[model samples]
Target: MVSKVKIKINDLYKIFGPKGESHVEKVKSGMGKPELLEKHSHVLGLQNINLDIIEGKIQVIMGLSGSGKSTLIRHINRLIEPTAGQIFIDDTDVLAMSDEELMNFRRFKASMVFQKFALLPHRTVLANTIYGLTMQGLEVKEAEERAAHWLKRVGLEGFEDRYPAQLSGGMQQRVGLARALATDADILLMDEAFSALDPLIRSDMQEILLELQEELHKTIVFITHDLDEALRIGDDIAILRDGRLVQQGSSQDIVLNPADDYVGDFIKDINRARVLTLGTLPLKKASTKGIALSNNTSLENAMKALVDAKKDSVIVVKGDKKLGSVSMHDIVHAATRSSETAGEAVTYR
Candidate 1:
């Protein structure tokens, strides 16, 4: 049977240090849990990570440098085996695959783009795009034709002959993206692939990734430290800290109902208007004689209704049917409570 969840991680652990040692020790020390892990020296790259990457949606694993975002993505593709825990891709335990099985899994199922572009410095863009398929024994002509297709798909229609050294950083990254696409894998793993590009190009790349997803519906696991990027590109987000998952939820849910303080602080300054929607707010009975807002409208937009409708209440409508109303007081309350709840979740982490 096809799996409902494209990726599943449960009680996952990755420790760095001596072989057979726990990494949580190092994790504790760094997080000021030092004397706490006094019994061991291993560093916990990931701790009891429990998450589900829904099929065909961009799931951004977000955190700072040491938060283990990269380590986590690598786990999904089995680039680095988890020290302990279970990782499943389409119902198969990735960690249980033999060497050949793993190789086949990677070639046919997972494709990745990296931060450094990972293009052959000496090869032309077209050659680099076809490199992976060529390794799998595809004929030169077939691979070239496929490469040309992705080149056009990624808007690099005419730059196939240029070498990586000859292209702008943005263009080089596109070549890498095209190469990954050419592999025709079921999943795409991107590790800060746009961080090296200038802001303007990064924004363009973000749009490109979204459009690609719309057409292919390939499951995507993207890593990023930028909150804005996470909010913009992720269908769901899994926030990590101290090498452990802090929280996971839809972008709107995370912004509207943060699981902890670390997440709240991470998103505190975010313009709510850009991150929250009516779905984030609580709905009340409508026919009680009060103003209302569309269920699809954002809380920020609903706030406008509360203000412009000149009433402390607004109705919530689902299509033509009246769902409920949110009073001005509830609006302010939800807003503040959500932030505080996030702050509280931070304490847990």
Candidate 2:
């Protein structure tokens, strides 16, 4: 994890007020957000944000609206300068980079997908996708080849000649994705990229992103307000509240052990049976097994299989080898338990 870190943000802060800098010390001295705002008339957009974005993994920053999730992501590319902090990408000081250096970094090192599908309305899909490449002074022929390749990869093959208005909302977002991917940037900054799509379309886009990530391994920083979306797509999830990080860890860690009541309530409505996978369940020594199921199966599906087969327990297998066994009772109990509980374990084989 240490060696693979692609971006590190240290002691980041963003205060929105003319006198914001003066209030930094007050806020740091154990002042609550409400009190600070009331006394100083300043809004803290982010507070002491420290994060390690691992290479080739999705790091989701999620919270309700006004929680500073969006504010935190923009600091990566210096889209929104921080009041105080240091940002390092590949150990390069982003905050210290010159204008020309920042321009090159944005052109070649990072690409962004916005919630609004910020496509050029008049430009053809191919033209828009190739915009980044052309900015780098690549030849038109070479740029078109790369852009066309990514357009096809993102399922926009025949729509290359179509403008943004000619495409469906989902298709327009696909064009946006292709444009970002065409840049061949090491980091993908997706700010609620699929939130504007319909539910089914959003789900489809999520699957598409996951499929692409499996192959591309881009360092992704995804911003979302949806807990389900975060859990589904994020390899590491960071929860923010009132401009402060409440918790950060794997999805399983966050769900099984929420940092506080705020976080627990945030995930209270989540369907655990769907969110949890069999591999994350407690593993036990394989014993009397009625049916064998893959360790990667979802808890919901495993429960359904157990019910359909009239089995109390199922042996968990990875490949041909038995890994452990999990019982219907354990699954039910684990799924129903309050987030505050120290979750029960499934025995491992």
Candidate 3:
């Protein structure tokens, strides 16, 4: 009963007009709802989006390009205004904030990391990390100490004197990560911060980010199109499609129980073995016995075990006692379910 909502995005919407300059006098005058207008003629850039990213949680906002993922992330920090809705960060109404309040919020409450690692190319790493503190008018010595601390935390300890152009993609992103962390903000809005790198570098960045999240526990609202990356970093995931929130839940739920055809199609080719758990697929309890497996193992993986064991089924165990089992038949049954088929997924704990 004590868990509180941290970041709440309530029924948000944003629209775009087909014409250049994107005029909407009716919306400005508060005479027309964006929904009705967009349905008939306007382009709905974002539609009735609702999300709650809890404090100290890593929530990934994932979708294909044009899925409104980026648009939704922008609303939290007022980088882009919503057409309608209320966004509250720590119960503070974001839209109602004055210029001073907004500035203070951005200065002390939220930090954003971009795909391009938006660093001042001319500035040294230490200088860039301290930029936000300088803007707040902190003493130069104090800011430098704080920046140095964060630089060390991000594994850029000796690179304080290096410029952005002197760093590699991963190294530059480390600087970006350092800058964001130096702000000591409670929330980090990352919009494809690692998407620009090669796969190897992206994996390294992901590990670095995971370590950072573990150390910082900042409520991160991340936007990404890569499914593996989403599964890697997200504690909860909200999927968007064509501006609407298609589904929101743990990554397990989305993979095992997709909300719609569109979502199913998206996950159709994913290696369910890597993404699912033994708890996701059910095993018929027999009249006699079963073999146990760690709750962490997936059915696709469990199937391999079943084959290797040459047994009728295998049990799911937490530590000692058996929780459940999966037979070869059960393995085939779960695996054979057409990724495109319309049916409810069976999950047993």
Candidate 4:
């Protein structure tokens, strides 16, 4: 089934300077970032970015410091206007929205989760979660019910009256998430939402988001600098470098076939076995004796399952139907093969 596109970004460009628009031609004509800054005194934020964000899937945009990942997410809600381009949400041109229309769009169509847990420090957990609904003029009773449901859903059932200072970093982040979800908006824009948490808490938050996605499937555009997080949660990923999209694809595609030396170096140390799924491996005839595994099973978990069953291969299934089989040899080869040498054998479907 072809999923509808929830958001479309076309020829997006953002330059940070007084005369940024004047140099768009120069940048398009092969002017490098350093040269553009040195010669024109303009900083390129994004250059000709065209992407389709499918409905009900997580699209992760990642890069190091000075990359335009953060800038790009803001453009969706017109927090930062683009120098040139169009943003379409469900076919409505966001860039074309009037002041009132844009305000409505931000309040009703989209919700943002910030890295710093942008909860009003003065408001309690329940108040923060109901903030959006209240802003939308929902009845007090109705909004409270909605807020309470999401707070409990995010595991903050009793934290309703606690201030942000009283909760741990993880708990504060949960309030931020609950706020976004409470809005019940169709799109969730998470800007480095989990980056500030401790490692274990960060992992737990990722699991929570994925679990909610299974039931809610809001169109999520998650921003991050961590490659592992991107691979772990993104249904599709777009990598940005110096305002340009270096690569975009499934986690397996980028891991097995990096677009350039820069991307290759970025993923060199990633624990691929933990992120690469069985669906990435080539499908093969199933053997009757092996245990069954899901197509989305991680290579690491699949290996553990294989070892536990005393089997060398496992049949991959999606629901009740068998997709193919994967052997222990394939998992090891896929995880160990150098990106330079990766080809058909290691390439997952």
How many pairs of residues collide in model 4? 1
Clash list (residue pairs), candidate 3: 291-315, 292-315, 293-315
Residue 211, model 2: lDDT of 98
lDDT of each: 0.82, 0.90, 0.82, 0.91
- Candidate 3 backbone clash number: 3
lDDT of 2 by residue, 1-349 (tens): 4549999999998999897888888878778778878988888899989999999999999888889988898999999988888999999999999999999999999999999999998899999999999988899899999999999988989999998999999999999999999999999999999999999999999999999999999999999988999999999999998899999999888887799776787788798887777778787889876689998787889999989999989899999999889888888887777665334332211
TM-score winner among the candidates? 2
Descending-lDDT candidate ranking: 4, 2, 1, 3
Predicted candidate 4 versus true structure: per-residue lDDT over 1-349, tens digit per residue = 9899999999999999998889988888988888988998888899989999999999999888788999999999989999998999999999889999998888899999999999899988988898999888898789989999999998999889999999999999999999999988999999999999999999999999999999998999999999999998999999998898999999888887899777787788799888788988987887776889999898899999988888999899999998888789988898776666334233211
TM-score of 2: 0.91
Question: Which run of 10 residues does model 3 get worst, by summed lDDT?
Answer: 20-29
After superposing all C-alphas onto the true structure, candidate 1 shows an RMSD in angstroms of: 4.1
Best by lDDT: 4
Selected candidate, larger TM-score, 1 vs 2:
2
List candidate 2 stretches off by more than 4 Å: 1-3, 279-286, 316-324, 338-349
Give TM-scores for every candidate, taking all chains together and pairing residue i with residue i: 0.85, 0.91, 0.85, 0.90
What is the RMSD of candidate 3?
Answer: 5.5
